[model samples]
Target chain A: MTTPLLEVTDLKIHFFTDEGVVKAVDGVDLTIERGKTLCLVGESGCGKSVTSRAFMQIIRKPGKLVDGSMLYRFKKDDGTDEIIDLAKLDPKGKPIRQIRGQEIAMIFQEPMTSLSLMHTVGQQITELIRLHTGATKHEARNRAIEMLQRVGIPKPDRLIDEYPFRLSGGMRQRAMIAMALSCNPTMLIADEPTTALDVTTQAQILDLMLELQNDYGMALLFITHDLGVVAEIADDVAVMYLGKIVERSDADTIFNNPKHPYTQALLRSIPKIAMQRDELEPIKGMVPSPFRRPVNICQFQPRCNQRFEACSRVEPVSTLINENHSVRCLLYEDVAAVHQADTEAVAHG
Target chain B: MWQYILRRFTYMIFTVWIISLITFAVIQLPPGDYVSTMVSQMINSGMDELPPDFEQEVRAQYGLDQPIYVQYYKWMRNIIRDGEFGYSWIYRRDAKDIMVERLPASFAISAFSVLFIWMIALPIGIYSAVKQYSLADYTFTLIGFIGLAVPNFLFALILLFISYKYMDQAMIGLYSQKYETAPWSLAKFWDLVKHLWIPVVIIGTSGTAGLIRTMRANLLDELNKPYVDTARSKGLSETTLLWRYPVRHALNPFISTIGWILPSLIAGELIVSIVLNLPTSGPVIFNSLMDQDMYVAAGFILILSTLTVLGTFISDLMLALLDPRIRLS
Candidate 1:
């Protein structure tokens, strides 16, 4: 395939909080190509949001970039490619700034708070446009109005003068999208953007996003815990459990044949209309707190119904099963002698 | 919005009325009126023989013979009809005239202290918060604790001592010897500026430290907010991200502080005024209190409390303007 617009390899973002090192995003790998959507799906604390924040290097204080390489390839205005290792850029330096909001933009989970209440939504959009494009304020105003219209705000003129508090949740989320896309960024990272909206609004926001992605042709990194949303909008799906991606595949494969027990469990938990009326099975146990993560075992081994002796002794590494599927589960591993020896060791004990 | 302001304005009038009544009552609470205080002073100073009708004449001159509510009504009528706050027994001048002369000095120094306190506090607070746990943050944090620990009077005295010992100029008042009573001129202005620095430093240091601690805490909380993250993710420069988003969010409480700061500067300056010998209303009203100059003390109390109430109204108006969330409500 053409060079991925962004490729993250073995990314680890740890928050050095007072309690201890929180391995919030540990050894995650992700990729998204231009004009395509990749959904990073996980329950809370699985580090989907943290990994997306890694791209912008906007993680909160007490959070550190322990180790990672995020290689972002941009097609410059002249149509030639430039690749930069995003991890190494000083978060406060000049180069990262040029790429930020200009090359990449993001929408957040809480539409209520994602846009500053103190500033007019139009001013917010215009400010970003002006900052990145060096356009005159008047020109940016026009661009902001145009974006507000494109995002389906009525009376762009009046709405342009209004603050975020005046807008409804869907409208605010749309405003956020409008602001994020104003620069025609090379990539858009949306962290659970529609999770807070009502069902109808959520669908509309997803549709607006997909439509906007088509219009802008930007790579989309969509992070959400909602599998239905993943099924609806994701071109590629990566299922995360406890800060690691345990399964990666195209949407259909991720749903039809999830290999990792965590992904299978997540798929099972998605309520279906066709299923017999029954109480939904939540994953058997709570996600282990970051401070208590097992150092050398599969993080999901405790919760995995199919867990085994080897699962408790060693961390399971990703094993490629096909051109489009990868799984991190010993159940799918080709039973090697090391596992046999490990099982023997456990048996002797 | 106009309705809100009008309602607030009405409340302000009521507030001022209640404040004036309370101050008048409290001034009366000290067990003697101005004539008693004057007669006692005369007795202590060897003028033991009472002049015929001396107490009666003194009492009649100030209208002190009326009942309490009647006296209040007379005072309120004078204020309403002629803008007169009554007469100062000690200065033997109209209280309004005393206010006119003294208001400027108190306002100038106190206003400067308020402005100086905020200007110094906000930026330091923002910096300390954004770079929390950094060396500068720790250093400023230490200073902030020190500011909170030491009383304002002590801080003022320490500054006074330092200025006297080091500068040798004493920096004793809001103006130097020649300009203390001098009429307005560029020379007076410069001297005012020169003297202004000492009180501003004396008063502002502690205020700056206190506000910095508060602003830092408020901004730090806002810095973690989702809007701030969104702003940063949009690649707002660190300065832009700070000043425009989280700082703006953090400013509501700080703006509301304007009400507290207005009278605080004036009230907090009283002890400092005594220490530095500054010719501000603090010491003037303070002397009135000691001499039991009823009208002057009550008048100053009335004016300062009005300012405090007015300050709260102004801050509320500002809050409504600055925050749309509040504006809608």
Candidate 2:
């Protein structure tokens, strides 16, 4: 099988601040195959957004990617295998510039601010196209309008010249998406794209993104805290708690059989619209402060019900419970022995 | 917008008129009238001791023999109706001409100082903000305090010493020679600038310190704003992020204050020019006040007032440009 489009292995982002060193993203590993969607779910301050920003190499001052190897394996123009290590790419070098926007585009939260207030929405999109593709102004203009229309913007010809402030929140988001997608990038990193929109608009944007992903055959890295959103768009899910990935697996396995107590608590906390109010159970206790993180198997030990004494003594490694699913949890350590014991007992009974 | 301008202009006129009236009154109330002073000085110097009729002639010449209210009424009428600034007793020329000649010099010095101040402050301030608490920031802060603490006269003395000791030349104080040396030629103007630069810088150094501190504080605030982070997430270059968003936003307060900055600097230039003996408004007004040349003093005041008004207007326009939310309306 060919390598995935993007693979982030052992990613760690730390911040050196006046207070102390903060491990913002500790040992986060994620993969997105071609045309697949990987949703990162966590509460506020969980470092989900930091991990996504790390992918784009846009982490701000005082925050830095201390260690990480992000490998992008894609087919070059000559159909030759090309694998570039993102960690090795110089931030100012042409390779990173070539990948940013041309290969991977990002959709930011707060569309109004993300879109340049000074430029017309169309101009912003057209400029990006011209910058990456070297298209003539006229060609880029047409492409921009087409992208806007494809994104379901009304009267793309007229709307293109309007500023972001002139457009509604939903329309601005669509304009942002159009701008990001105008370059025809291979991967889309949507960083809470729908967090600021109204619920109805959120659904529309999510659907539009999914539709575009399908049409363009692009991989997606969706960074959000809303599990409801995850349930809808993600094929794979990663749960982060205090800068570390607490649990990660196929979406089905993660939703059905969450082994890590934090994952289970997160799953339980998501209020179900289909179920009664009383049936809903939210996660107990707040996420621990990153500054006060303990050296142990689980960062969730304080809130986790299944946490044992041993969990505080040593960190747990990821254990593969199935061919496609894996989780970092002490509870999953005896799964194979338990399965064998259950088989013998059932036969005797 | 037009209404706003009209209202501001009206208020400016009212303020100038009130200040001028108070100045006129105070100058008149002083002991030893201008006519008596002239006559006494003539007699004391034994300059043929003006004829016995000279006392009446001097009083009549100045219209000082008229009632105070009447003199004030005529003065107001001449200013309002004839648009005439009366002659100066000391200069023996129209007060308006003296003011016109001297106002530009003061303004030039002020303008040059302001330009230097902003040019130096902005970059240093921005770098200090970006480097925050680094050695550069601490060093600049220390330098700013020094600039603040040193008085203009002392600064002028220091500059003179530096020029004499290092450059092996005597420092220019104000003019090349005196006001009678030459008319305002380009060479003379440049010479005047060279002479005045030390004083101008001395006066402006404090202002530069203030501006640098303000810019640093503002830039820090802008850097911490969420929109700056949003800009970063858009894959914008660091230069663009710093200059386009943070710098522009940070400059709004400084830009808006330029109107006040220019006039206030001009006011400050007055004192510095006097100390440095520059042929500028400070000494001109100071001489007129001592000689009871009310017209020249009032005229100088009026010119400075006008500059302040115009400065504020320019600042308003700049604020609108710098701050997007300040719409044209």
Candidate 3:
């Protein structure tokens, strides 16, 4: 009934290199409701990280958001809903800066390298707090200490003065989380934040993130290639291939009744308990290079086992199978056409 | 930290002692002493060969008749006890006085050249790295290569020619003719400043070019690091992000280079000083070595070695201060 926290429509990000333009993120659409998790699952170079970076307007040079509008909804001081198109704002201008860490914050993959070794963890945390909140030095310090404690770090007082290199990988990730959550942002974008951690530490970090998300009631955009993590944390799932999303649905539907062949292939690839190690089946073929994207056809057709004749000639648009599920595949075109006709007939009647 | 510094200082003293010993020995390695050179000069001028007693008397007067170790011990003891640097045979004065007189000018030129190098190289290097592969970056790379390829003395000559031909100004010495022998005064200082730029530019060229390449490469590497992106994601301004993160890391290498600057104060730009006719330590040392002026040459070199040790110690301390990882280790 209420508007989603953020709605991204037709997002396209291109990287212009000397060789050619790399359509790194082409036509990605996503929605994140308040207090829910959206896991973007994809293989490497599939543009999941790039899409999340676009939300923060932190895309590095050579890669640019060439099209799309990100409609972000937030409450003003007067308790009224206000909408802004994030894509239209100048990335380097003051408006985006004010909204960046305050409204939407991000955590990265490499905790060891994400925090600057030159500054104390306390200094890094307080810098963000003061930048957005305009808090006094003493206030920022106290807030940073409190945040460090909240992130489950022991002896926050002592660790505050320690440099990032002095902390373990999990502790560094925790510090990063504390810094991201310090501003009480409405949305958090985490790009494979646990990829570098061991299994135990990864699980701890995931639990901490879930607890924090529940407490803050913030929308989470979790990007990862790990299906196990997605199953554990994601309420909604979107499968990405190359630069396009192939399937999106509620987590249960995606796990139980995956519509797109790419999603099925990805599910089959995950190693299961009680199964032999050699029994795992990986998706066939390398992801086609971004420079040579398939023309006028489904991006996943080459990798799909059940691909039909129409898949090679027609690019599949997102087709709704039900109220809560959508897939981009030529197999579902007839269902989408029937649904469209029904909607049109009802509107006329 | 204090203990570390004290240990380093101790090592520095030992290093300086070894350097002094080596310098004294190397200076004495030539075939003859200053007295023999003087006798040869006198004989070449058509005088009859000096009597055997005359050469022995001259050698005894200069302490040259003593064993090499005894000569070294006496020189070192005199320097440690009374700050004396023995006697200059060529200038007929104390070596200390000659060094004190010429060293300030050399120090000024070297200090200003280092300042010039840092000031120009830092901003341009940061710019070149941030705008890598841009037209400006390419232009600076070209200029840096040219600076590094051309020798300092040759560059000095070219600058002198340019200034003479185009500006009609003979940019040759540290001061105009009037201020050459003038005592220390505001006017003499200003005249020195007016002529200081040429040598500063010449000496600083290669160092500046080298530092620019270093800084650009260092900063370019730092710029891609994940910490930079993390800082940017915090909504810091681009300039703030750049200066606070990558530039801070890039500056570590430059801090370590401060060690070499002290020795370069006396030894750098030797030919440039000779070509420009400046009254600096480089030419004085050169002439002293050529004439077998043992005390003056040894004293200058000893001071240069001591400075090098002190500079390295200072740079180590500065590096530890800048990087916490180094500090803890």
Candidate 4:
């Protein structure tokens, strides 16, 4: 199909701590097309947040992106397109900074604390606009108002003068979104934007995001643990187990016919409305610590219910089950041979 | 905000009343009256005891013959009647006169020390925190420890000795003998500035070191916050992120600290001012304490405690104003 807006190949980010090396984001490949939402679904510490940080080159001290190529494809003013490797550019250098907020802005998890307490919401939004676009203060402020209005915040003029703490959680998240989009970024990375919010507010924020996404045509790299949230907004879904992607497919395929045993277990664990009388099923075991991770094997082998000898000793290679569907599991090693067995297992169930 | 301040003021009055009681209790804690101290000092100064009835006359005049509660009641009544500070037994002067005479010099030194502390501590504190574990941070850390280790009076003596031996600077007082009684003039002002630094350094080194550690730790804590990364991701430069988010966030602690800082500065100066032989409240309080001048000593304590309460209120209000999160709450 068309060239993706961003194609990340074998991104390996590790943290060298006093205790041991944490293979936070290890050899994971992900892609986001222009104007599409790609959700990185995983449990906490499964490298989803680290991968998002790597995208912006914002990985903190002791954590280094040892190996990766994040090839960002974008259109220039002359209508010709260019490809830049975000991973290669110095994180704090000029080139990456020019691209970071101007072309790729990020929202954070905690709405209460994501914006600074010292500055007014307007000032923060104006700061982002000016930092990237070289706009004058007056121009930046006007643009900030426009963005705040666009984010569905009521009374943009008044809210502009208020600080983050003055607003409710939903309003704060909206303000955060407003700040992220102030520079008219081509990509928006949201790290669990609604996790700290209540249910009704979460739905509102998610709706606001979807509307904003449609308006801006911005590629959205949404990192979250909530599968339900993924089902609502994602265009492509990448399920991460430990530091690797266990499954990558279109949203429909991921939900309807999850391939990896890890994905199957995750999908089964989601509580359904009609199944209220039924007790919720949890995964059998805990995720292994980063220090205890086994080398040269599937990360989920120890926790996988459908483990075999090959799953333990042999490293699983990604196999394409069909168009736009792939799984890193020995169960799908030979998709053509296993295709019939998969259909039978599904049909029988 | 007005109502809150009013409430705080009411509470302050109540607290001051309680503090006055404590001051009275401590004043009465020692066994002898002011007459005994006068007698002893006279004897120490190579004079025989005053005429046999001299002690009885002095005690009767100062109402030292009254019980503790009666004395406390009378002191409180005199304070309320005309806002009059009581009589000083040692110098036979008004308590207000002593405070009025000493207040400006003591105030100037304290203000200078605060300014010096801020000016030196701020940039170094920011640097130490930002480039933590660097050579500069380590050096500043070592300096901070040394400054903290030396007692303020001892530090003043050390500084005085060093200046005497090497620089040959006579850091004796807030001003030279001429300016001591001279009217305000340009030359007098310049001389004050020249001698002003001695007490500033002597009193401020420990405060500066303490504040540096505070600013460094506070900034370091703010640095690790998630908003810092969020700001960076917004294309804000490293410097911008530092001052905009973390530095502004750090200003809260500094603002909150200004309350207690004044009293500590005053207390620190009380010791250093003596070491440097500065003409401030330290010597007056010292002489009053040694001679058992109860009214003068008690009056100074009351003024100091009132200043402390007032300083805390002002700082708390400032904190609320600077930080909207607290203001709204």
Candidate 5:
């Protein structure tokens, strides 16, 4: 098979605060292929946003990328494949900058604040286009206008001159998307881009993003806590809990046959139209504090109604039950032990 | 925009008129008028006694014998119709003349001090915020606190003593003894520039420190804004990202402060002016108010208030220009 567009291996980002270290993202593994969407599903403070930011190397101070390798595969001008380890490059250096907006662009959650109110929409979009493509003023302006039109902004000509505040919430987010896609990036990291919009606008934005994804054929890393959105758009779903992906597989398998207790609890908690308000089943407990994560045990054991004694005694490793389905739970420990033995035997041989 | 400006202008005129009324009333509020002070001075000068009607004649001559409202109406009429700010009792000249004589020097000194404050405060504030918690930031913070704590006049005296003792320079007044009464020439201007730094530094220190704190706080708040993150994600260099986005937003406070700066041009750093012995409106206003020189005191105050209103209008216009979120309407 051809190499994936981006491969993230054991990525760990820790924030060193005045209080002890916050393991915001610990040992996450993800892969995204060209023209596909990988939905990172997690609740607040579960490091989904942090993981996406690490892709652009825009993590703020006191947060350090402790360990990882992000191997990005792209085609050069000569049509030959080249690989670069993004984790090794300096965030402030020229090489990473060339890749940041041009190769892997990001759109943030708060569309209202993500675009500068002081600048016109055209200026912001043209600035990125010019920075990445070195296009002349006229070219950049035309490109920005085209981008705005592509994102379905009405009256792109007049809207280009307006500031972010002049636009509605949905339109502002559209502008942000236009700016991100202006450089024709190979990967797009969207961090809950529609969370701030109204329900109608959110649906429209999602459709727009899917249409754009199809047109651009870029690898889309869509981060959100909305399972409905995941069901609607995600081809591959990775359910994160307390900074760890407990279950990952194709969207159908994840929804139809969730293996991890956390994933099961999450799926069960979704309130259906037929259910009464009091009939909704929430997961048993709050996500454990990041500082005091459960050690030598399954991270979800405390909240798992089906948890067994072995869950508290041994940490569960990711075990492959079948092709395209992996879960981190002691319920699959028998399969994990066999897989571990097979890998060890091969290594020893 | 034109409509907005015109509206603000009208409001400014009304505000100035009200301020003038209050200033005139406050100047007259003290128990004695200028004539009483002059009479008291005459008695202290060893005049055994004056004619009983002498005081009345002097009072009538200056229109002080009239009722307060009548006097106010006359003062207002003179200002409106003839463009006169009444007469200065002590200076024995038009109140406008005294203001004109001292205003240029005052304006020059104040303008220089503001320039000094802005030029120094901006970069240091940016640096302190960008490199927050660095050694340089801490050092600047310490210096800024000291600057805020020390009174301007005391700092002025310290600078004066330092200049006199170590540099063998008197550093008092706006110009040297030779240029004390010298008319405006290139040489006089050059001499003024040479002596300008001492007063500029003295008057600017507290403001500079205050602005540094303001800028640092403002920039720190802006630095973490999501827009800044968006800018960084655009592959712009850190410096370019900072100056283009967050720094522009952080400058709102500085623009808003232009309102106070204009009035400060005439009346800022009053104690520092006295300590440094500069020829500025502060000391003139002080003396006039002390002796109840009604028109002189009232005139200076009225002009200062007008400037304040005009400055606020200008600042509002500038803020609208800078921030698109602020609609003039």
Candidate 6:
């Protein structure tokens, strides 16, 4: 295994509210190798989005990162090795600011809200270039024009000068992507980039991101709740539940042989295009609230169909089920016995 | 935008007419006749005792014996035809002429107060909000509350007392040392500004406090916006993040509120003028009411209403310019 480009260990983010402490992100462990894509898949309030925001240290007040560190390793221009803990950087200082757009860029969910409506689309992209790369205005403009063209915007020059509201939703998302990739970042964290977009635009943006990722060979931490998107772009996948990674494996393994019951449910929930279903079989019961501290092994026990007494009594540690696959479920432990029982039941039937 | 302005102008005219009619009716109604009140006051002070013909004399002098609608019609006719707002029974001058004469002084004082308030406010407000619970923020907040708590009149009185103690005389409001019936001159303007400081500062202090609190709340709200978070995530400097992003968006609310504050500032100045005894509109309007000077009070009300409407219009225009989303309609 090569050294991961980014490593997050034991991340615990909590919000101190009047009601109680909300464990928005608890004991989250994530890793991304260079030139690979990792998707964190979960429903809302499951801490997938929170984990993405933690990388940028943009958590607002009443929210504190109680425990954890995100380490980024990079090779310097002088050929020296550099490692920095993202959590400890002064949020206002130049070092973090320099690293933000230049080394690690992000594409947000709502393009309308994220893009400055006051500025021209072109001006915003150029301004970012000038700020991080010290490019002159002319140089920035030329680069912005190039980036806008690269993102498949028609009449890139005219579009650059146009305000955000004047553009279509797809154009705005592409513009956001153009701005994010303008600095040639080593890592791109896209938080639900296609949730607000139409299906056709979503497919376009997904294709664009894949093309850019292949071209740059940068690590991509794609955060989404859509299993379809995960299937489309992700090389490695991690399933998150109530702020913890429930399962991690390659995209193929997670789709074919889902080890965790929650992962299985998520797979089954995806509707097939061939079948014309009126409604989706949404997972039963709401995700357990993070108001109380999570105890025991399986947070999924309450909703799990395969649950037993031991599942509720003891917490399960992550057990390696195969190469490049690990799951935090009691069923995965001593799999030979479980497999034998399943085979015997099938034969009897 | 042009259509919007034209519509606003039409509305302004309608609003001014309504305001004028209200003033006219209030004065005409059963409280006291403008002419008889004057005659009765003179009669009460034993200056000269008039016979029963006194009412008749007053009625004939001002053409008040006419029907109420006819009287209003004549007044409106004169206002539209000659731009004459009739004559002030108390000041013995044309109402419109007196308003023109007094307007510059009131405007100068109000403009100065507004400028001073903004200059002192924006920085302090932004700083306090950014620092949130820090000691500097707490201190400024405490001072802001204290500033808001003190009445404008009391604040003027404190300054007056301080000036009296130091200068051995009443250092009053925005009047020159040679202000009594003096012609306009540079020396007089300079002296007026020197004296203007007390009233302007006092008038502006309370408003300054209110504005700081407003700006702080608005900017703090903008700070929490996801766009600001997006800007910060781009690795933009804090100053860049604030000025380039939230400040522009935050200013929209303040720009809109300026319309409301214009009226408050005028009311504030009225109090400051009375307490400090400067010959600004506040004193004139107050004295006119006390003496039941109908034409002078009515004329002043018309001017004040016009100013309030225009101030609001200007604020709306500024908001429209700053934020593209707001259409004129």
> For residues B60-130, what per-residue lDDT tens digits would candidate 2 score against the true structure?
87788898778878888988898788998887899878877787778778888888898888999999999
Top-DockQ candidate index: 1
Query: All predictions: root-mean-square deviation over Cα?
Result: 2.4, 5.7, 4.4, 4.7, 3.4, 4.9
lDDT (Cα, tens digit) per residue for candidate 5, span B120-150 = 8999999999999999999998897888688
* Model 4 misplaced stretches (Cα beyond 4 Å): A136-138, A276-279, A334-349, B41-53, B73-83, B177-180
Global lDDT of each candidate? 0.86, 0.80, 0.90, 0.87, 0.88, 0.84
How far off is model 6, as Cα RMSD?
4.9
Better of 5 and 6 by DockQ: 5
Clashes of each: 0, 0, 0, 0, 0, 4
lDDT ranking, best first: 3, 5, 4, 1, 6, 2
Tens-place lDDT per residue, model 1, A157-237, is 899989888889999999999999999888998999988999999999999999998888888999999989998898999
- In candidate 5, position B162 carries an lDDT of 93
> Mind giving the per-residue lDDT tens digits that candidate 3 earns over A164-234?
99999999999999999999999999999999999999999999999999999999999999999999999
For model 6, what is the error of residue B13's alpha carbon versus the real structure, in angstroms, after optimal superposition?
Answer: 2.7
Between candidates 4 and 6, the one scoring higher on lDDT is 4
Residue-wise C-alpha lDDT for candidate 6, range B291-329, written one tens digit per residue: 777778777887787778887888878877877666522
Off by over 4 Å in 2: A116-123, A136-142, A155-161, A274-280, A335-349, B1-77, B87-93, B165-169, B178-180, B183-186, B189-193, B224-236, B287-294
Full-model lDDT, candidate 2? 0.80
TM-score to native of every candidate shown: 0.94, 0.86, 0.93, 0.92, 0.95, 0.91
> Which candidate's lDDT is highest?
3
lDDT of 2 by residue, A1-349 (tens): 3468999999999999989999999888878888889999889998988888787787777898899899998679998978988878766556776777878888989987776565578767776787778899999999999999999999999998887777899999999899888878889999999999999999999999999999999999999988889989899898887887777887888888887888888888877678988988877787666788876446777777887755665456677778677777767767565455445545755
Q: Which stretches in model 6 have alpha-carbon errors above 4 Å?
A: A274-281, A333-349, B47-52, B68-70, B73-83, B133-138, B166-169, B176-187, B327-329
DockQ-best of 2 and 4: 4
Residue A257 displacement (Å), model 6:
1.9
- Residue A216 in model 2: lDDT: 98
Candidate 3 CA-lDDT value: 0.90
Candidate chain B TM-scores, in order: 0.93, 0.83, 0.95, 0.92, 0.94, 0.91
